[model samples]
Structure formats: structure tokens, C-alpha cells
Target: MKLLFLACLSPKTGNYTTAERIRSHIESAGHSCELRDVADFHSPSDLAHLVSQNPPFEGALAIHLFKAGRLLLDLRLPFGVIFGGTDINEDVKDEQKRVVMEQVLLKARFAVAFTEKLKEEAEFVLVSPDSKIYVQPQGIQTEVAEQFCWTEFLRSSEWHSKNLHNILIIIGPKVDPALTAEVEAVVKRATGVFLAQERSQQELHAAMKRCYAVVNSSVSEGMSAAILEAMDLRVPVLARNIPGNAAVVKHGVTGLLFSSPQEFVHQSQRLLSDQELRERVVRSGKLYVEEHHSVKQERETYQRLVDKLHKAQFLA
Candidate 1:
């Protein structure tokens, strides 16, 4: 079966990585899955034209409900949806987007949330039934560039650090500009802070491996892929205390959570000064990722979903 996978494909972002990973999973099951950036299509008509083009897609899957799943409505093909961070958390607060998302959920054959908290939120906010929603945590995988040097990276960025612990703060494209600017302002006051922007996955992984700790200051998340990747790479994480972050980071166990900018600084200092705490969390974090976010398990889950879709198609 040929499948069409639609997602926000911003360069060097989590959604793009996820779309690619799921595409690989579908393809591994002997299906041809075409990944297209959701930004390219403006309306349902645009998607209809693409679907009408050569060979046609037997099934479709979209990452974000309103952004991608909206296009799937009234289309002939069967489709599924995976909730994006903002759609469930921030976007639903808006009356218009909430209506659209509710419609999308109603029409979708299935929907996925990365965490159980998100699933419950979606069901409560969007009034979606439990039977339609599945909780499939994002899979974790990391590969550091063999030749990448931390010193060279710092040099390229014109950052000169003398034995100071390197703390990485990622600036994702989807984050609110005001919130991002505020977070940057606070984090930059600390020593050895690297504000990473538009880095390839390899570079991000390499930096995470060498950094003293990775920080997530986002106001909301759909299970941050970076936090999971940081854990998989054995890097300690310091995340903002949001429901999404809370779902993954068990305070002082998997990672530390901070409720404010001041707490983030305090936690950073504690993690850096206390080697025993750092080692314990890093070890437990890695073990957690291995047990809960394995690539093989993720692949199998999607494969099972695809097979179910295929069986439904055959019966139809």
C-alpha cells in the first residue's frame, strides 16, 4: 500500500524528525510512504490535487490535527492523526481552532498523543472519545558525529569558555517569539550557555553528549523529542515544569524540573556541583528511555496500526 504522511517539516525540528521516523516505519512494512511538508498545502483542494496525481495514496496520516488533518476531511482516503504540541495545549484554547480540531478528531479513524496526560487533555478539551485516541510516546534515538569537537563548535560560534560547564538551550522554530526571547534573556545570564539554532540532528546530538545539561524552557510540549534524546544520549535534562515535561521527567529521578527561571538556575548549579545526583539521574534516564521509548517498539506500534488500516481497506 502507498501512504501519504503529512507533517510540519521545519528544518532541524522535532516534528520533521518524527515524520521521517514514522515514514521509515511504514516503509519498512513494505508500503511506499511519501512524506510531504504540511506547510506546502493551503487547503483541502491543494491536497485533493496532490491525491489525484499519479498512482494515488491508499492511506494518509498527518502529525498535527488542525494543520494537517484539516486537509484530510472529506477526502476519499482513510487517514489518522497524531497530535502536535500546540494543537492540544495552546491552540485548543482558541475557539476557532478548537472547533476545527474537534471536527478533525471526529473524522479521523484514529488519533495519537505522545503522553497519557495529553491524551486525557485532548479527550477533555476536544470531547474526543477514548476509543479513538492512543498514547504512543515518542521514540528515542541519538547518534553523535564522530569528528565533531566541542571546542570547535564553541569556536565556530565565537563562544570562549574557560573550564565552565556548557549548558545548551535549544531555540525551536515553533516556540512563541516573546517566550523564546524571555527564556533566552534569562539563560544567557548564566555562564557557558550555548543558544543552539537551526542545527542538524547530528550536531544537536553531538552537543547534547558534551553539554553539562540540556534545558527545555518551552511553555508547552507534546513530549519533547529533544528531552528524550538527551536522556538517550546520557545527558542530564533541566526542563520547565509543564504538564508535558512533568509527564517524562520525574524530579530528581529521570531529570530535574524547574518552575521558574530562578529554580532553573538553582537546579543547574545543583546538577553541576553534585556528581552523585547527576550520575544517578543520567543512568536512570537512559534506562527509562531504553525501556519506554525504544525504536523497535515504536516501529512495531505503527506497523500494527498500518496493518489495521490495511485490513479495514480490504474489508471495504
Candidate 2:
């Protein structure tokens, strides 16, 4: 089936990466998939024109509910909507977007949430008894180059001069002002903590390998690719103890979760001093990623969705 995969195709962003991975799986299954940037279309007519040219496209898969799925509303296509982090975390709180998202959810043949907690929250808001929300964690794979020099990376980062356990904070281009200030304060108040932002995926992976622990400071998330990548690379994680983060990082098990800046600072020290704790979490983290977020599992899930959608479209 020829399919349109609508998502924010910004390079290295979470939505783009997730859409790309799903698109790859669909294409690998011998289905033709067109990945279009949600940002590119201005209106339903713009999208309608694009789909018209393709002629007889089976369906579409939209990445974010309120953002990307909004445009697909009038397309009259049997589409599936995938929830991005901010959609369930922030947009559901906005009255206007929340109303539109509920309509989108109603129209969607099925919707996806990264965790069961996220699905529960979405279900509460949509209040649909027969909602087709599914929990599917992101598929992840990690590999550090054989010649990756941790010491050299530290020296270049100027983190080597400070005798501290370097912590990498993964951030994107446009961060919330409040979140930015909070992360900055954490870096300043803590002596050894360092910020590693604005790096390429490969660069970030190398940094993840060298850093003592990776930190996720986001107030909201669907499922953090960075956290998964860190776990895949056997790096211990310190993340905000929100439902999404908690869903992935089990406190003192897979990784450490902190409620406040004070807790984060305290845990940072613990992560540095407690060798046994660090080793156990790192080992458990690797195992968790291997078992939960495998490429094979992700591919199979998408394949099943594709088949399901095709069958639905054929019957319709």
C-alpha cells in the first residue's frame, strides 16, 4: 500500500526520528511510504492536493495528535495518530488544542502512546470507552565507534579540567524558558555537572559513552530517545521523576529518578560515589533496553499496524 507518513521532519528531533523509523519499517515491508513534513502544509486543502496527486493512497500515519493530526482531519483518509511527548503532556491542558485533539482521536482508526501511563491520561481526557489507544515504546539501537576516545572527548569538551563526574544534559533547539533556567541552575549549583547540548546524534552517543551519567531535564516526554540510547550504551541515567520518565527509568534499578533539583544534586553525588549502585543500574539499564526496545519488536508492531490498516481500508 502507498502511504503518507506525516510528521515534523526536522533533523534529529524526536518526532522526525520516530516517523523515520516507522517509515523505514513500512518501506522494508515493500509498502511505498511518503514521509511529508507536517510543517510544510498550511491547510487541509494543501494536504488534500498532495494526496490527490498520489491517487489511491491507502492511509496516513500522523506523528503528533494536535499538531500533525490536526491537518489530517478533513483528509477523509483512514489514518492512525501517534502521540508525541508534548501532545499528551502539554497540549491536553490547552482548551482549544485539547478539543481539536479529541476530535482527531475520535477520527483516528487507532492512536499510539509510548507508555501505558500516557495512554491512561489520554483516555481520561478523550473519555472514549472504546478508544483504540495502544502502548508502543520507541525502537532503539546504539553503537559507539571502536576508536571513540572518551578522554579525548572530555578534553575537547573542557570537562577534563574540572575534577568532576561529567553529566550530559540532552536538550533541543527550542527549550522552554523555565526548563532552560532550571537546567542552567542545576549546572551552576553543582560543581562537576556539565551541559552537553546541540550535538549531533553520533556526537551525543559518543558523549553518552564517556559521561558518568546522562540527565533528562524535560518537564514532559512521551518516551525519551536519549534515555533509551543511554541505556542501550550502558550509561546510567538521572531523569526527572515524571510519569513518562518514571515509566522508563525505575528508581535505583534501571536508573535514578529525581523529584526536584535538590534530589537531582543528591543523586548526582550518589551516582559518583556508589560504584556498586552505578554498576547495577548500568547493567540493568542495558538489559531493559535489550528486552523492551528492540528494532525487531518495533518493526513487527508497525508491520502489524500496516496490515491492520490495509485490511480496514480494503473493507471500507
Candidate 3:
């Protein structure tokens, strides 16, 4: 079967990485899968033109429900959805987007969420009994470039400080220019806080491998691919105490969680000073990733789902 996969293929973002992984999984199952960046299409007519120009795709899949699913509505092709964090957590707050998302869910053959909590959130939007949502955690795999020089990376980013032992890197979405400048100014005043600019996946993994700890301070998440990747790379994580982060980081066990700025400071101090605790968390965190977020398992799950989708499409 030929499949069409739509996603926001922005470089260095989680959605692009997830779409790539799933596309590989589908192709590995002996199917032809073509991935297209949804950013290229302005409307359903654009997608319709592509479909008409090429051989018809037997099935379709998308990462974000509202962003990508809206384009699938008029295609009249069997398609599934994978939840992008902001669509359920942030975008649904708008009544118009929520209504459109509801229609997309009702029309979709199936949907996928990264965590059970996210799946439950999706269920609330998809109240119809026939709507099926699967809970599939993001898979973890890390490859650190051997020649990646930590000192060179720091220098390139304009951090000339020789004291690199306790460097704390902040990784998050890009904000407005004014807000970003304000944040960068504050970070510059601090001793060792490094604000990461956009980097390729290989560079990001190398940076994660070298950092003292990976910190996630996002206001919301579906399930953080960064946290999982950090754990997989055997780096201790300090994440915000949100449901999505909490679902992965068992406080003081796998990693540390902070609800407030003071808590984050306290936890960071504890993680740095207490060598035993740091070692224990790093060990356990890597183990958890190996067991729960292995690439093999994620691929198998998608392959099974694709087969099921094929069967359903055949019967219909």
C-alpha cells in the first residue's frame, strides 16, 4: 500500500523526528510511504492537487490533528492521526480549532497519543464510541558524533568561559524576539546557563551527551521526546512538575522534578552535590528508557497498526 504522511517537518523539532521514525516503520512493513511537510500546503485544494497528480495513496497519516488533519478532511481517504502536544494542550482552547479538531477525530480511522494521560485528553475530545486512540510512547535512540568537540561547540555559541564542568543547557521552543532577547540577557548575567539555538539532531544529541543534566521547563507537553532521549543517553534530567514530565521522571528515582524556581534550584544543587543520587538516577533513567522506549517496540507497534488499518480499509 502507498501511504501519505503529513507533519510539520521543521528541523530540530519533535514532530519532525516522530514523523520520520513512523515513516520508516511503515516502509519497513513493505509499504510505500511518502512524507510531505504540511507547511507546504495552504489548503485542502493543494493536497487534492497533489493526490490527483500522483498515484492515489491507499492510506494516510498525520502527526498533528488540527494542523495536518484539517487537510485530510476533503481527501476522502482512510487516514490515522498522531497527536502533536500543542494541538490538544494549547490549540483546543480556541473554540473554532476545537470544533474543527472534533470533526477531524470523528472522521479519522484511528489516533495515537504518546502517554496514557495524553490519550485520556484525546478521548475527551473524541467522545464518540467508534473513535479509537492508541497510547504509543515515543521511541528512544541516541548517536553521539565521536568527533563532536564540546569546547568547539561552546566557542561557536560565543561562550568563552573555561569553566564548563557544570554547564546547564536550556532547550525549548523559539519565542518572540523581544522575549528571547530578554531571556538571553538574563542567561548571560548568570554564570553557566547556556541558551541553545537551533541545532541538528546529531549536534543536539552530542550536546546532551556532554551536558551535566538535561532540563525541561516547558509549560506543557504531550510526552517529551527530549526527556526520553536524555534518559536514553544516560544524562540525569531535571524537568518541570507537569503531568507529561511527571509521567516519565519518577521524582528522586529516575530523575528530579521541580514545581517552582526554588524547587528547581534545590533539586539542581542536590543533583550536583550528591554524587550517589546522581549516579543512581542516571543508571535507573537509562534502564527505564531501554525497557519502555526501545526503537524495536515502537516500530513493531506502528507496523501492527498499519496492518490493522489495511485490514479495516479492505473490509470497508
* Model 2 C-alpha lDDT per residue in residues 79-155, reported as the tens digit of each score: 88888888888998899999999889988888888888888888888755455888789999876654544442243
Clashing pairs in 3: none
Per-model TM-score, in order, reads 0.90, 0.88, 0.91
lDDT of 3 by residue, 117-210 (tens): 8888777765544348888889888888766665533543334365556566675557458878889899878766666677778778887888
CA lDDT, every prediction?
0.84, 0.82, 0.84
The count of residue-pair clashes in candidate 1 stands at 0
Which order, best to worst by TM-score? Answer: 3, 1, 2
Pick the winner on lDDT between candidates 1 and 3.
1
Task: Name the candidate that leads on lDDT.
Answer: 1
Clashing pairs in model 2, backbone N/Cα/C closer than 3 A: none
Off by over 4 Å in 1: 151-162, 166-196
lDDT of 3: 0.84
- Candidate 1 lDDT over residue span 108-163, tens digit each: 77888888888888988997778999888888888888765655335323343544
